[model samples]
Target: MYELKTKETDDSVIEFIERVENLKKREDAYRLLDIFTETTGHEAKMWGPSIIGFGSYHYVYKTGHEGEAPLVGFSPRKAKISLYFATGDPEREQLLESFGKHTSGKACVYINKVLDIDVEVLKDLIRQSVTFLQELYPKEQR
Candidate 1:
């Protein structure tokens, strides 16, 4: 498995969010931080240089590729807020259909504003994604 340094939760993530160009977007980023931490019971951590991630999981594909990724995360990108999580199983696609006013890019869901989506629905999406991943690769493997 490819090894990555275990990420530590830090206040720098909040500082980074504060630096977002749009005030409303910055607030939305912080709100996502709160929801992710509260629901996942994992503090926010800066991933690489930009992504604000919560919890983590280690993954090794059958092809022998491996890496560690956040259990759930988001970034306030210049174009839109990019939400991150596993997109596995059929039910996840069902949730995405009802997720509202958002675009999916690869594995990340791009939303312009948190106000554009249902907060509770977003929470359920995150919860289900995390649970689905856990079933495939438990926390102990992370």
Candidate 2:
């Protein structure tokens, strides 16, 4: 039984943002908070100690491993902000072409700040992530 380390908690999202040491990152965190919330239509929740997540869904793999995860989220890290989105969406790569300056991994996109990326593309990414997850885990209610 593997445990999910990033389970959602009752931690204060605002306090977490306030603790970000960098002034610009702190401000970007606030802006991202608004973007994710408005785009997903879900209030932010603290996932683990750092991730500010907007919505959630449960997933079970073919091997029987299962856990809950946010539909979209972001963290203002020491080096850069990490944006979480659903993986395996081909459209994500297409959108990133015009997303301004950002780097991405399988499930996370890294950006210096909100100003460095196109906010409209960010919103589309958020929406696409939520839609992709919901479709994949259709029975799990958010």
Candidate 3:
């Protein structure tokens, strides 16, 4: 297992938020983090270099790909904030339609600012995504 180097990491989650050049973006990120953890009943951890992640699931596909990953996470990218979902369910695509100003990658939703989206709506989306993952994968496998 790879240990988290929290102390030595300059971009620790807290410090990263503090460094956000935009105030609204910073506040929104923090709010989403709180809501995501509460709704999913999971704690958040810093994944890889910058993603703030909550919950985790282990996945092995028919192609022989297998790995454990966060069920939900976000990166405060330079151009926009990117929300990640490992599963690309159709319902999630529908959610993005009404999710306010955003664009989508295969499994990432990109948002420029929190003000561009409804906070409550975002929370609901997160809840739905986690629920979808749990249903698709067994508890042990997830």
Candidate 4:
């Protein structure tokens, strides 16, 4: 059995954000906190040590792996801020076209700071991700 490392913890989201060494990154973390909470309509929670997550869902893959994960989240890292969103949505890719100054991997979008991206597009991405995930795993979302 594989263990999921990113399980939600009782850690303080504000403490984690306050520990961010960079002043701008720290500020952006606060901004992102507000954005994710307001957009998801869920209070922020700490998913692991660093990730500030909002909302959650349980997902079971065809391979029998299942776990709970955030509908949306972000981590203000040393290199760049990592934005977590649902993967495999074509609409997400389309929104990224206008998202500005960000690089994305399979499941995360990395940005230097909040000012580097369009906040409206970020909001749309958050909205679309929540909708897509909730619809994809309707019974599992809470």
Residue-by-residue lDDT tens digits, candidate 2, 1-142: 5678999999999999999999999999999998899899999999999899988898888887888889999999999999999999898999899999999988789999788999999999999889998999986343
- Clash pairs (backbone) in predicted model 3: none
lDDT of 3 by residue, 1-142 (tens): 5443421122467776677787877887887777778877887777777788888776667886666677788877778999987556777777777889988888788999788897777887888888787777667764
What residue runs in model 4 are displaced by over 4 Å at the alpha carbon? 140-142
Q: Rate the local accuracy (lDDT) of all candidates.
A: 0.84, 0.92, 0.76, 0.93
RMSD per candidate (Å) reads 2.6, 1.4, 4.1, 1.3
Greater-TM-score candidate between 3 and 4: 4
Model 4 C-alpha lDDT per residue in residues 15-134, reported as the tens digit of each score: 999999999999999999998988999999999888999998999898978899999999999999999999999999999999999899999999998988999999999999999999
lDDT of 4 at 116: 86
Per residue, candidate 1 scores C-alpha lDDT tens digits across 22-120 of 989988988898889998998889887788988778877899777777888999998899998787667767888888899986688899999898888
TM for candidate 4 is: 0.97
Q: Which ten-residue region of model 4 has the weakest summed lDDT?
A: 133-142
Scored by Cα lDDT, where does model 3 land? 0.76
Between candidates 1 and 3, the lDDT winner = 1
Deviation from native of the Cα of residue 14 in model 1, angstroms: 1.2
Question: Where is model 2 more than 4 Å wrong at Cα?
Answer: 140-142
The local lDDT score (0 to 100) that residue 26 gets in candidate 4 is: 96
